[model samples]
Target: MNQLLWMAVGAGAVLSIEGLYWLYWRYVGSGSVRDYINEDQEPEGDYRILRKIKTPNQRIALVEYRGQMWIYGNGDVMFSTTEDENMYAEAMVHIPMAAAGKRNKVLIIGGGGGVTTREALRYSEVEEITAVDVDDVMLEFGKHLEAMVRFNRGSLNHPKVRTVIEDGRTFIENTPMKWDVIVIDVPEPTGRYPRLSRLFSVEFYRLLKERLEPEGAINIACSTSFWMPEYFWSIQETLKKAGFQVLPFHHFVPEDGEDWAFCLATTSPVDTDGLRMLVSTEYLTPERLKDMFYMPFYFANGQNQGDIQTDDNTVLLDIVSEADYEQDGNRKEYN
Candidate 1:
């Protein structure tokens, strides 16, 4: 019996050591997914990775899915869609722009693919489009890549457009130019991406309020209210605390596999009665704009008990990290 017990203990120790090593080798030792897969061979079954870009900040992958191209940052699909409709981009820029009425100088933060800038240029009133992003690699992709340039209507290279490779918040802090329409198209306030969540904080919004024209309006991509409601409303509350009258709205994005929320904030009244498009678009209409503003009961009351995000408090990260959300495209279970 003693000998049998010794053998059992020895076996368990060996198995545990082997399991730990396997984990390290698979995750830590392996540099990235690109390192494991052969570049020449199609490794993701239905989806094929065309190119992978390594920046100091993140790993970017240009993927081809069902004959369509998608840009993914750190395993998540970017908000910009390749489709002509580009519902997300149109909705984010136009409604607030229409409200502002005479927006000449527009500021876009985190315009990764230049799609947001593309939508902004549709307004004939917009004279200058300043796109600021921390990732120069992404900016270069927007400037030169055939697929990205095609979808973005060559907005990055447009004479009226200027691309700045700097942290959005830092640029805003230093720039003397007060913008007419400010569009915040950043990633979700999750831990995977660093420093960006700070953009959603009250202090940061206050900085935005400082740079914004009195009559100017701001729009933000507020992540998924369908799954992570707490994170959504906390951001809504943070914006309000920053001294702006806020209007929270949402739309279903097929790429994200959920309903994504957005906040339209203004120093003045949000009177979009005169909303009209200066250029042609496939998706956004007056009727649809009315529907987009409708928030359901669950989404309206999402912030049950949470403090506003602050520079020192770190509340948003705690909430975002604890939330259980599913992004369909991020996993092997893409449908």
Candidate 2:
């Protein structure tokens, strides 16, 4: 009996050691999913990785799924690589046309995959588009990624578009050049990562106001209002605190499966009547844009409890934390 007990203890010790090593090998030792797969050979199924970069901010990946490419950051799909007529990319394109009647110089923050800059280039009045992002590898890889370059209609390679590899906050704070249109095509503040929380803070919004021309306008991604109203309200409050007249709007994105919200803000009131959708787009029209201003009853009155995000305090991060979303049934199980 004593010898049997000794053998059992030894087995348990070996199993424990193996488990710990397995954990380390699975996460720390192996870099990313891309590291395990061969570049020349196609991945198991229809999905194929075009490019993958592990940035300090997040793990960025360009994945091809079912013949379509997707830009994913930190396990969340930011947008589709293919140019879908009914996607958010189309709606965001019309923002410059709707807000800034004359687009001369535009600044795009977090315009990954180069779609936003592509959309902005459609305006004949637009002269230059500067896109800034933190991940240098992703930006460099985007230049060569066939799916991304083609989807943007070669806008990434256009002479008018200038790409900058730097943190969005630092770039905006240091830049002296003011912009006619500033588009914040950033990721949603889901609090899965802390680095993204600062972008939605009141301090950042204030910085954005400083960078805009007197006649300039800004576009912000407020996330989906379908199941998360607090997230939308928090952004509105922060933007208002930064001293801008905010116009909140929502549109149902087919790829997102939720009513995503965006805010058009300027120092002065935006005359929607005078605004015209000069660029032909599949998603946004004059009639559809009119309905975006009216918020649904449930979405407008949801229980939004959280602190206002500031430079010192990232309250928005706590509001949309992945743990909280998991508990609240807001996040899908597979996602």
Pairs that collide in candidate 1 are none
Relative to the true structure, candidate 1 reaches a TM of 0.81
Clashing pairs in 2: none
Q: Encode model 2's per-residue lDDT on 80-140: one tens digit a residue.
A: 6654523677666576556764589999888767787788888888889998888876676
Worst 10 residues of 1 by lDDT: 326-335
For 111-139, candidate 1 gives per-residue lDDT tens digits of: 86888898888877789989998888788
Assess the local accuracy of residue 135 in candidate 1 as a C-alpha lDDT between 0 and 100. 88
Question: Number of the top candidate by lDDT?
Answer: 1
- Whole-model alpha-carbon lDDT for candidate 1: 0.75
Runs of candidate 1 exceeding 4 Å displacement? 1-45, 79-81, 253-257, 272-278, 302-306, 325-335
lDDT of 2: 0.73
RMSD of each: 8.0, 7.0
Once superposed on the true structure, which residue ranges of model 2 sit more than 4 Å away at CA?
A: 1-46, 83-86, 190-192, 254-256, 301-307, 322-324, 327-335
Best by TM-score: 1
